[model samples]
Target: MKRILLLAILAGGVVTNGMAQSKGNLNSLGKNDPKAKAILDGVSKKFSQLKSVVANFVLKIEGANNSVTDAKKGTVYLKGAKYKVNLDGQEIISDNKTSWTYAKDANEVTINNVDPNSSTLSPAKLFTNFYDKDYLYRLDGEITEKGKVLQNIEMTPTDKSKNVFKVIVSIDKKNQNISKMKVFEKNGNHYTYEITSFTPNTNVSDATFSFDPKKYPGVEVVDLR
Candidate 1:
């Protein structure tokens, strides 16, 4: 079960990018440059238009010793404050009110009612609010991955308690979608999330985020709240 939650933390954290030319060279702009602000403004505007999204991808986790665990062929659903992640046949659901982490192998589930704002794991907070302020974003050089050119941005949070020490987001310039993310935690842990497919503003059902342990009769329920 701890392995599942650890995967959630990595997926929600690590496994969690821009445009233009002449103006395209905004990558060369300094932190205080107005051109940089203009570029980031455009990116932020595009980001604001995304209300909900669904994606299919693989999350690869790497340890300090370089051991890797890959959760292949997974789906992630996101709404305002709710998210459901299914990876390698296991599921984790959170509605900004309650969270359920279910392990298929052990037939056990852990439930916790939490303040959404208190968790760095919240997708809304991770994608929207954190990007709004409290961090410095600078465009890095472009790179080609999976045959697509991506604009890389480095983010460092100003607040210490956020648990994140640094982050890098690779954004697809044409679609303005995030292609990859790498997060470095203060505890010397790091996580990386790469997106293989992304569908924005899809009609994801509310029931997808619902948790009913009774549905799994023999499953053990641990109330962590």
Candidate 2:
């Protein structure tokens, strides 16, 4: 009789384990439900309409070892398909046709044309569209920051040559604006951008996106093209 009782207890244990495993799977499925997808789609649609914007930003860059560096106050001007970032007393300009990085301290500038197919420092890709063909996306969940709820979504690139390993975007639900972005590279490097303010459809002058090297006489221009 003791042998039979021992066998019954072993069988009961196996059944209990199976039920627990099944419940865990169900919970995982719930996290990927349609609610998250709806939130992502709504935010993407809102960003598609942005044509021009001018805003003040405070950029914070963190390294792989969690070392942090902060940039001083800067002004960002964006028009149609061009952008200019004035930071650290230097100006980085992309005129939709050509791009230039002007360094005031070193008195040097690097110039290159915009490569629509390549993913680099092109402001066009950073603000408007993404290379969705080489990446897959999933909505992570909702998070609250600064008393506002945001939809957090994760993106993983399929093409290894893309260099980008993962990307996370936190989009504000109420304003349909992106609050934060984190990019992780395959080399273990990462970049994060936190948006402090956003003003859409602001009228920016065309000269803001133009580059005139003659204005900076001592700066050397390096052409990367």
Candidate 3:
């Protein structure tokens, strides 16, 4: 149970990634080769144009034996630096500064200050700002899956001490959106985040990123800030 809780927190934590300098929020740290830069530029530009985005995703955690240890389905709404994620037993809402994490099973909510530069992989970072300086990326070529052409971009973390060793991103060439992402961790644990559905230019309200305790009855709020 402790392990599961840890994983849940990690999944729900705030992660900072590099948004292109052109987008006015540059935080990337890795050196991208020409080909990688071009491909990432397309992704960066496409997402930067969105007022909001909503996507359904599946998270699979695999063990060392290549067996699935856990799997969960979730939905994410992202706008600017704000995001809200909904899973079966958990929900994370963040407005870029403040973050609220609720675990239904525990009937508890934890609030904290969101450090955008944190080196964790959050859903918000995965979709928009994943390709920046923390990863040295290379284009691994294109492949067709389900009749859609995907450009495979391989990313190696610049920080060797990090638990995550490598990340492979599959981008849809037609839309320049991320089709899937796989993270290889040093502890023999693998996480695969697959976008099952994507909706761009969504009409998400700012209130959606802020948590309302009134809506959740009989829940305890723990302020970690």
Taking every candidate in turn, the Cα RMSD to the unseen true structure, in Å, is 5.8, 17.1, 5.0
Per-residue accuracy of model 2 over 100-169 as CA lDDT, tens digit each: 8777888988888878776443455543334434344556878888999977767555566766677776
Q: Pick the candidate with the highest lDDT.
A: 3
Residue-wise C-alpha lDDT for candidate 3, range 99-175, written one tens digit per residue: 88898999999999977666555544544444344556667899999988988877676678977787778888898
Clashing residue pairs in all predictions, respectively, total 5, 0, 3
Model 1 agreement with the true structure over 94-114: per-residue lDDT tens digits? 887888888898998989986
Rank order by TM-score, top first? 3, 1, 2
Ranking by lDDT: 3, 1, 2
TM-score of every candidate? 0.73, 0.72, 0.82
- The whole-model lDDT of each prediction reads 0.62, 0.59, 0.70
1 against 3, candidate with superior lDDT: 3
Error of 2 at 156 (Å): 0.9
Q: After superposition, how far is residue 5 of candidate 1 from its true place, in Å?
A: 7.7
Model 3 TM-score, all chains together: 0.82
- The TM-score, computed over Cα atoms with residue i paired to residue i, of candidate 2 is 0.72
Q: List the residue pairs that clash in candidate 2.
A: none
Candidate 2: regions farther than 4 A off = 1-37, 65-73, 126-130, 223-225
